[model samples]
Target: MKKIYLWFTENYLSIIVPLILLLIWESCSRFNLIETKFLPSPSWIIREFFILLSNGELVRNLLISIIRVAEGFFIGVSLGIIVGIQVALNKNLQKSVRFIFGILRPIPVIAWIPVLILWLGIDESSKIAAISIGSFWSVLVSVVQAIRNVDKKYLEVAKVLRKDYKTTMLDVILPSTLPEIFTGIRIGIDVAWRSVIAAELIAASAGIGYMIMYARELFQIDIVLVGVFSIGLTGIVIEELVKVAERHLLRWNTNIYQEEVTRKI
Candidate 1:
């Protein structure tokens, strides 16, 4: 009883709200208070999830979306980092890159779908292009700004030392800007992953987004909810993975700061 009370105290709000909502939802479904077509019960969605999983349909579609995200994210973030580095290192190229990408920045990932389809056709290439654009812009903007906002004192000292742009970028800017670059990567990957669903939903014949859209057309609310839940859970997992990578890779930064503090003390 004591353990139970402690557990409840620790997990109450998080567990209770969703439990109550599910209970209410289930009751509504059982009593016909809500149309099954519009809002299927929690149990129905869960059962459908298991059914889809057993048949491999859910896994297959999810894999397709994940693959698309991987390919596009690699292309986009790689380009973003490369271009950002060049832009920071060269004034002439910086102006050209900034102007070109800036004009294209406001256009959204979903918005690019139609243009991509028309240019590349309604195929995997277009879908990947849409996802890539989403990632590229996010990382590009973050990387450029991260460099621009690098601790001014370092830049000032570098300038006084007559450091060239390349030297300053390599010695002073790169180290300081890594954290922000990681942040950009996290955001860019999330954006690209999200774009996969929309790209597939809008045009493709396969993928998680297509599954949801297809289920909606068939009036299978449970399946639609299952797909949505899959996306949400996958997103949470992706975010946590990025955070773990960031902490691991930047662990040295933490040690350096601690050493500096200890010296001052």
Candidate 2:
């Protein structure tokens, strides 16, 4: 009990702030301080969330969305890192792709939905493509900028040691850039989420975005809010997962660097 109490004391603020806000929101809704149409009572949304969950609609749609995000994020981030490194290091490579990427990158990924629908059709392919494209830019730009921003001093150290291209990149450039690259990856996640939703809203017959849009059409605002909350909550979960992975990987990186320095000395 004491341990639980201590844990609560440490973590209470995080819980309490949202709880307080929910109370205020519930009061407003109950008192009609805010219309139930625009801002449904917390209780109503919770009730709807459970109803959807019990009926398996929410789980099915959420699972579908999760799979789509996983596949698209993997493909997009893999390509982004591979291309970003080459473009950053190889002027010739940059020259080849720069013109087209420059033209295409300026356009928002959401704007490509109509064209994607036309080319790929309103199926999983089109939606996944939308997510991949949306996830690409943030990571690509992050990697490219990270390489450019690598401390010249590190390069000077590599030169002094006469490190080969592959060795230098593996040991120096990558470690130097991982943090920034991860930052971009974090941004790409949000983009990926938004892209999936937009694609679903526009063309999908299923998924969370479709659920929200369908609810809107029927003027089921409580259901709409439930979908909105589901998306937000799930997005938070995904980001937290990434952050946990980042912390572990970064800690490992630090250990590797220390071992290398110690060995050299």
- Give the winner by lDDT: 2
Query: What 10-residue stretch in candidate 2 is worst by lDDT?
Result: 256-265
Model 2: colliding residue pairs:
none
lDDT (CA) for every model shown? 0.86, 0.89
C-alpha lDDT of candidate 1 relative to the true structure: 0.86
Candidate 1 TM-score, C-alpha based: 0.85
What TM-score fits each model? 0.85, 0.89
Residue pairs whose backbone atoms clash in candidate 1: none
Model 1 Cα lDDT, one tens digit per residue, 105-124:
89888988988999999889
Candidate 2 residues lying further than 4 Å off, grouped into runs, are 1-11, 95-99, 160-162, 252-265
Model 1: number of backbone collisions: 0
Q: What is candidate 2's CA lDDT for residue 203?
A: 88
Q: Lowest summed lDDT over 10 consecutive residues: which window, candidate 1? A: 256-265
In each prediction, how many residue pairs overlap at the backbone (N, C-alpha, C within less than 3 A)? Answer: 0, 0
